[model samples]
Target: MDHSIGEIALRAGVTVKAVRYYSDLGLLDSWRAPPGHRRYDEDAVGRLELIRRLRALGIDLPTVRAVLTGERTLSDVATARAEALAVQIRTLQLRQAVLRVVAQRPEEIHQMSDFTEFDDDRQALVTDFLDAVIGDDPELRGIRQTLTPELPDDAADHQVCAWLELAQMLPDAAFRATVRQMVADWRSDWRADDLRPGVVAALRQRVGPALAAAIDPASPEARAMVDEITADYARQLGKPADHELRTRLSSLLETAGDPRWFRYLRLLAAVNGWQDPEPLQPIYDWTRTALRHAG
Candidate 1:
């Protein structure tokens, strides 16, 4: 059964004027009552709801009318809207980057177009940081990939914050240099240890359990863990575990193993929406304790 235009508007959460406008546009099915009152088909409420949904997605009146009249499929229109949203997101991200640079470094306002050019290669900044830190060795490909955060067009608030913080940090000259050399030491003379993950893997394997068990960093157990790791390193390098090696290893751990830079890794994980790997700061802390504690 048909209902008056007022009933259709109430059901569709629209005004009576809107229902009449659609009816005037021939987009709604309506009939005249015996008393000449305009009534709409029950299905008009469903159709009007669909029309509103499409309009909210930014579909124009002509396209929405086509959709209602069966000239276009809803699936096709939805896919088009999704693709449009992706493009819109990319444009907004580019603008946000430029504005950030301008705000952070007003002196660089003359070169603001550089940020605009970032649209062509969105990863340029990230790539430079990774190259400076890890170098361009093929052996480091996987680690490099893991470290770079890809902020999607539709990122969550935390992810956006992570990217903003990372972008700010990427331009620091001293931090970049420090991390560059630290990665070299962490990988342990990359020429010999082409397996870049092994040194950290070895350290983590020993320290993870100790950290979980809440063993004192200065305890005998922590000391044993340190001794075992140093021995393993010596075996890998075919060098004696002597004063020179101990001193170098201790310094390396102090430099690279600081949890300071690990903060950036956590931010990277957050930005990329990845599970944060086990934090290595505690591992370094345990090793540092063992080295200082002569017991």
Candidate 2:
């Protein structure tokens, strides 16, 4: 038995207009009955239902037709659609990350817009920006590597945000100049043991406990911490850990250390999945304060 257009629409749980639209597109076949009225077979109901499912998945009319006509298999269409949706999902996620950055730093919104996607050119620009600011110093090569955000094609939400923040920081004139000066000052100093890994490791091992204990920088405990750290540095530099050396080290710490500069490294750690080295900052601060009044 044949069903009228109204019956087909009712059976498919669709509107009369939708049934008519699909019929016009040749997706639903209809025949003229005795009274010249449109009549649809049971197969037409199944066709209409399939069309509805494909449209719900955002498949275009042509692709839907291809599936209907056997030009493409259902699996082929579904696979292609899934890949397209993945691309759209990534685009939306990146947009969300960009907006989050924009909201947090409205004044820097201009810098956030250029990163809708991180392509090779953008990656190269980021590297060049770092190289220009960091200079060609062999001593800082490790630092350059640590600070760069190597964004993968499938970066996570936090990684994307890190990349955006890193990008914005790269072009900042004041941040660049401060970092450059700090590197230069570190290289010029004879007792800048912080730049040496073994000395820093020693400082952290000795000073870390005192900092955590909240020992007063002026107290004997904190003074002992400073003395131990300075002795190690003095041995490396072949100088005595005297009051003058301690004063000069305190002055250098005052000039070069900035918590804001450390934020870049924190962002890098987030992007690269590194163990967070945040505890070192407080230890350094505690040592700096102790050294200031060591004399």
Candidate 3:
């Protein structure tokens, strides 16, 4: 079955000139009829549709002709297109990060080149910051890895923004000392040695609920909850549920709740593209209030 040039163009939803152009390029088939007018086979409609799609992807006539003539596999054409899109998407993300810095953090625009380059010196700065805070203990290797953020060469928009935010904090002496003290305080309690993660869980599992219920920290309800939490901490430490241990629990959770420390975890998660950790600031605040009013 054959179709006139007009019929083929109409069926393919293209201009007649578009169909003729492809035919002229030898990418589509057409023949002269007895009347010396061009006619296309029904297959030309399908081929014209393919040409439109391929051309829209920026494939030139020669490659499209090769695809149409079976000189190249459609898979090969698709792979090239997918790879090109990956590069384009990565570039767009970087452009978006720059735009955000200009629009939102105009004052910080001078720092744009740092993220753009992300050279070895920039990474060394991160390493030094981590070492000052987390230390070089062999046992802390896992903890160091978890806290450290490795910004990739082709980071996404949010990741680039995250690195920018984290970088801002890197040079702040007060913040660095705060984080360093947090690690020191944590390590002092041997929570890192025996029950670091467990202590955090104790706070979330117990203090989280009473705070949500708005229980007054000084009330018996709050005291009992605190007692149970301390006892849980004692069990993790293999210590007895005694007065000293109860006091230790208050101290334990108190140090863990610094607002700045919580922000670092969030920024770390963002930089590494991990699931944002649960918001524990409120829980830490609850613990702080509970301790303040426990008398």
Candidate 4:
């Protein structure tokens, strides 16, 4: 049956103007009426419904036309459209996160720069911290490379959050010095070959008990533990476990005990999604306290 544009639009649940627009676009075919009005065939209603359905899905007019004309299958068009929608959703989510951060910290608005502004200062700080903590040993160097967090050029909201947390930790001078001293002491005593077999084993045997007993590092009990451990270490080195050795080991424990160093590690772990190291401060403090009285 021949139908006027208005009749087709009513049957298809589309506006008259929309039907005319689709006819003009050759998406809905129409013929001339006797009175010079436009007429559409019954098939135009079905075509109008297809166009409406595709448009509702955010498929652009051109793509819709290609699908309707059979140049591309509906499945192909749908797959492409789904991919495009996914990308748009991701962009929107990132924008939402940025806005949330800005709203939460109005005072820190200046810190929110475009992702392109992720500069060398941030990169260098991250590199330096990893080096200080992990050291320059060849084995650790490879681990450092693998664990490095490279801020993306166009970071999403989560990456920005990680970057800000990492930046704050890396810039603390006290934290840097603590890490440096710890690394230096560790390197002086243990080579890569001896790390697990000697140093780790010794620390675990001697310090692990104090750590487990919850002994205060600065108490006499902790001192006894340190003395026992240092004596063992001295024997391994074929040297006397004298006062000098005790003092040196004490210094290592104290430097490694700093909470700020642990804070740095915690921040790095968070940024890299690693499991947190056990809290060592309480045990280390116990060791320090114990060492003072043991002398």
Candidate 5:
């Protein structure tokens, strides 16, 4: 049976105006009844349904027309639409994460205001900011690699929160200077072999336990921890584990041990969905104190 535009629209779940528009766009074909009203056969209803489905899936009208004209298969149209929708979904998700964080801290809304226009390349802006803080120092290549934020397309709230927190720090001149100075000092000490890889491992492995135990930094056990680390440092420096070495080592840690860096590490872990090592600043502080009196 033939159906009028109104009846076909009701059956196809579209407005009469939409049916007329689709007909005008050659997306739907209809015949004129003798009474001069537009009429569609049953096949028209199916075509209209296909058009609705494609449009709902974010296919553009031109692409939908191509699908209707058999220039592309339904599968091809669907695949293209899926890819486009995926990009849009990611964009919306980023905006949603930004807006949620902004809503909670309305005072910081200005921080997110301009970001609304950012596309998926927004992560590049963050990387650029990090590069400015890190500079072109080749010694910090590893730290720079680790600190780079690569937010997953399907990032959860914690990851987004990590990004928001990190983004907030990018413009902080004090924070940038702290990290820059730490990197510079680390590089300077690196040349003299004052800071070495094994030293950090020893501190983390030996001093970490004492710090966790809350042992007094001036206690005998603290001295043992300091001795273990200094021994490791002395091996790296090819020097005796003397008071002078201990003093220099303690100063190195004190200068590089910014609590902000600890926070940065924590936030990076959150962004990467890694387990937190807990806070390391406390351990560094305790070890620095212990190193001073290890004599």
Candidate 6:
């Protein structure tokens, strides 16, 4: 049977005013009563119910009208609305994290300004380091220029947190100097050529068994392993495997093997939506400890 507007409202669990609004919006069809007052059919009652449910989900009236009029399908509208809500939720969560950080570390409140004005300072620091190292060599410069970590315009809470921690760590004068010196050493032709090949060969020929057995870096086996690896590296670099070279190599390994650099790479991988490398710090440290003992 046909229903009056009030009856439709009661059945749809919406106010009479809301039903009238829907009718005005052309979302609910109505027919003339005996005296031309609006009357609705069972279909209109069902349509009103659908509109109420969608409105409860924060769907705007225009979109609800579009869905009701078949200008947009329900599935498409629902998917769009879900995606919009997800973005809103993420934005709110980021704001909460920012506020929490500000409240807990009032001294670092200056950092909050940077979040709004610039990309994370850690990203800038990394960029500066790459530029300094590769600036002179056109071929290397091209590669370094291409190495950008595309952090999101609106990053998630954890990513922002990681960025902040990284920024704080890299700005210390000692840390910056250490990084610069390491980069300079690596840029030298001899050290640059020797790095990957020499390290890999040394590990394979000398430390393979200890690495396989997962020997602790401080263990006696690790010491012998380091000595063998150092000897191999010396031959490869054409340096005498003496006290000075051993000391230099040990220091180089420690600086280059900083956990922050690994962490930076991991975060950069995330920012750029790339696959992260397997962690290398443990192996590097094992190699370092072995070298120290050998020296």
lDDT winner: 5
* CA error at residue 108 for candidate 4, angstroms: 1.7
Q: Which regions of candidate 3 are displaced past 4 Å?
A: 1-96, 103-105, 192-195, 240-244
52-140: candidate 2 lDDT, tens digit per residue: 98999999999999999999999999999999888788667777776766677788677667865645556786777777777667878
Best prediction by TM-score: 5
Report the lDDT tens digits of candidate 4 across residue range 185-221: 6567442222334665566667777677766676766
Quote model 3's TM-score.
0.62
Cα TM-score of candidate 4: 0.58
lDDT score at residue 135, model 6, on the 0-100 scale: 55
In order, candidate lDDTs are 0.74, 0.76, 0.75, 0.70, 0.77, 0.71
> Please, what are the lDDT tens digits per residue for candidate 3 over residues 151-193?
6645666777777788888878988877776677566745543
Least well predicted 10-residue stretch by lDDT in candidate 4: 189-198
Error of 3 at 81 (Å): 23
Whole-model lDDT for model 5 versus the true structure?
0.77
Candidates 2 and 6, the one with greater TM-score: 2
| Residue pairs whose backbone atoms clash in candidate 3 | none
lDDT of 1 by residue, 1-295 (tens): 7889889888888889988888899888888988899987778889989877787789988989878878989898889889988887787775665566567667755544533444345488887888788888887888788778787765555665566677778878877877877666656653434124788787788788887899887887777777787778778878886666666766766766556577788888897888886667777767767767733
Q: Which pairs, if any, clash in model 6?
A: none
CA lDDT for candidate 4: 0.70
List TM-scores for all candidates, in order: 0.56, 0.59, 0.62, 0.58, 0.72, 0.56
Candidate 5 to truth, TM: 0.72
lDDT of 5 by residue, 213-236 (tens): 888999988887677778877887
